[model samples]
Target: MKIPIQLNQENLQEVGSRMPIPDYNREADNTGIVHIGVGGFHRAHQAYYLHQLRQLGEALDWGICGIGLREADAKLQDIFNKQDHLYTLMVKHSDGKIEPEVIGSIVDFKMGTKDPEPVIAQMAHANTRMVSLTITEGGYNFNPTTGEFNFDNPDIQHELKHPQDPKTVYGFLTAALKRRREAGLPAFTILVCDNIEHNGDMMRKMLGTFAEAQDPDLAKWIAQEVSFPNSMVDRITPVTTQTDIETLAQKYGVKDSWPVTCEPFIQWVIEDKFSNGRPDFEKVGVQFVPDVGPYEKMKLRLLNAGHSVLGLLGALHGHPTINACIEDEVFKNYLRAFLDKEATPILGNIEGIDLTDYKDSLLERFANPNIKDSVSRICAESSAKLPKFLIATIHENLAIGGSIKFATLVIAAWCYYSDKEADQNGQAVEIIDAMSTDLHQAAEQTKTDPLAFIRQESIFGNLIRNERFTKLYSEVVHKMYKDPNIKKYMRDMISIE
Candidate 1:
């Protein structure tokens, strides 16, 4: 057995010649970007891009200082402290190739679970020119139905009352911006890297509204001075399991407390707008476009929505991973039908993007055998995901008199998945959603009231009132109840479409 090399700055030389290690002087680099919600996707995507830039011996000033906002982030803080803020990124190719590299872009980390003062100070620091976030779809703290910031949230209220002891993302951001303005420094660009539609616009509106409530002058200044650039980020980074850690140690002989694993595919499209000067990300395959709307819409509707299409239905069919689901012909065909028939027609015309080739590439990415992206991971936040991914597609299709059959089936599958909380094989499937209780209750009501699931105004929202949608939805739900052969149903639906 090869001896394991503990990953840290002092042991960089020991890990040499096995996988590529950072050759740059990490200590000399400045933290030009401060990223919140330093999760797997963030590490695998943005941080990896910066690492690639640094590997080319450029963008040394654009090092990252990562901050974790929740109590769970303390685990990351511990790992980063032990590893000297260094970790391995093991990229798994479709053909069973594993390429590992030590990424040194995340030079420092701060945990803001207990006290927000240090995080705020770091963001307010003069060297920090950009504040990026991957706080997930729900972290924006907006009402899904109204599309407005939720000021009544306890954390938001606390931040409003006690700005000095802020906790939420908005709280820390607002405090840091206030400090920067008072110090006569320019505002940093707010780059939101979440999967939301028009992410930059959403961030500006939410933050500006919050700032306005606190101090109107500060809100006005933020609107005038700060630049919120919309971006579309894509990469399939699965949750790192214990087996992944063991594989890294046993196969690669590198002992890392926490390392990220992902597919070789990655893409980021950002609007060419920044308040302070930005990094030359364009040098490293990052697309800086004028309007990210077309790209953003295409992704949200097809790639993201396609995930939900497979996730909800796949889970019910007893599939464990995304690749497993996509490998099955029925599931794959269903996804293709949803993309080609339902999603593509509404996308209008996206310049520089072939919808056919893009959809085909999505299938190839999902079928990557080495990436064990769990169905549970994809189905975790249905309440937050459906609105942007699948539900919006259904809404638009209804408006344009297009097909909602595929999307309607997915909703029916979600209801069954939520109600039974078990697969067709009688194995218990975990339900993870903020609206789990309500979802389960509403789903359970489908036994008597077939319309109960769609009646949730916050989620389905008037879709139940549409005659065509309600009729289609009711038929699908009843069919699921009477016969739970999801694969057969999917095949039949494909034939119908």
Candidate 2:
């Protein structure tokens, strides 16, 4: 059956307020903040916040122009077309409660491959104040091993060779800024919403690297004029399913075909810097921090790392979803012990939030039954996520002689999980990380020398050289593989006793 084009809003069964689209009568001119990669996370998190601001009668000029780089996401395109650029945001809560919000932050959408002209025009528009990016970590064409711009990438090479019709996200951003500079438009803020450490600094570095490789003067200008505000954004939005669409229609009476589903928790912390103009995003729950470092570390290390640890391990242990993983007695204990003993002590000062309470809340959020977030999804870019989430935490713990065993267990779990040929149910598991080949090789070598097996630079990075962590992790992995009663081993490893 063809899904209805509109949500039957009257028949909605959820408990959240239907925010009447507020009077955005203050018709401000089209000032561009070209957002690259309008994915599920953007719709659920950043766009939802913008929708809130719009609802409260602010940020009239804070309009977003979305650009999709690849053409494979025809489903998203079709849904937008059917709804006239509208969709539903179904927020899943831990308490079996649901909040359905209508998000309207995205005003325009353009395909980079097909409709390059409009996308480029919007990017170069005189009033374009910022270029916000939600492109995945790999989207920047950064080297998987070094975390630097992958200059040799064919798309990047094409972009550098043809600046007028740039293809890559970094290229498109720089080319647009170059055009603005020629038009005497002041440089715009480059807001980065990726999970990289010092994301703003990374953006500037990547742009600088891209431009310097192309033109020295353009690189110099970007270094001086661009504002790359470090930010931390968090929300657990799963890939939307057909069930989501049916729920929207049957429960809420809304007819959105491409409704987004997400966990209730959301956070955005921005460094207070804007060149041309910026939305009063602060007015809509976005914390304006003087230094976002502490919070960034907290979120990446605690929340994100927590997700990574559970995700791969969950998949390997026969749990289908994150909710199911946490329900398992062993994983639950592992997570609780991890947050309390291994993860929390390494955390330094973060302004306004209590560590204990924060961690407690995070566990509750993880245990949210309504949100069927899968372990495989969070494990998508474990290669990239591990550095930002796990490795740094390990470093901090090792430096202080703090307990890192539970954290090590998480890493060990990932190693075992990654090595597995089939999923828990005997289905073929897709290993998506760049280090998959090396990891598989190492996993096979584990029978001979577990420590030596993990020394692969492709996955473990330099941390494998640290004899102490390597030994501990190897011992844990050995125990896990050797144990006859795997559930007992998991429980014993996680137990404080």
Question: Which pairs clash in model 1?
Answer: none
User: What is the lDDT, from 0 to 100, of the residue 87 in candidate 1?
Assistant: 97
Instruction: Point out the worst 10-residue segment of candidate 1 by lDDT.
Output: 22-31
Overall lDDT per candidate, in order of appearance: 0.92, 0.76
Consecutive 10-residue window with the lowest summed lDDT within model 2: 7-16
How many residue-pair clashes does candidate 1 contain? 0
Encode model 1's per-residue lDDT on 289-357: one tens digit a residue: 999999999999999999999999999999999999889999999999999989998899988998899
Model 2 score (lDDT): 0.76
Candidate 2 ranges beyond 4 A from true positions: 1-31, 143-147, 423-427, 483-486
Candidate 1 lDDT score at position 429: 95
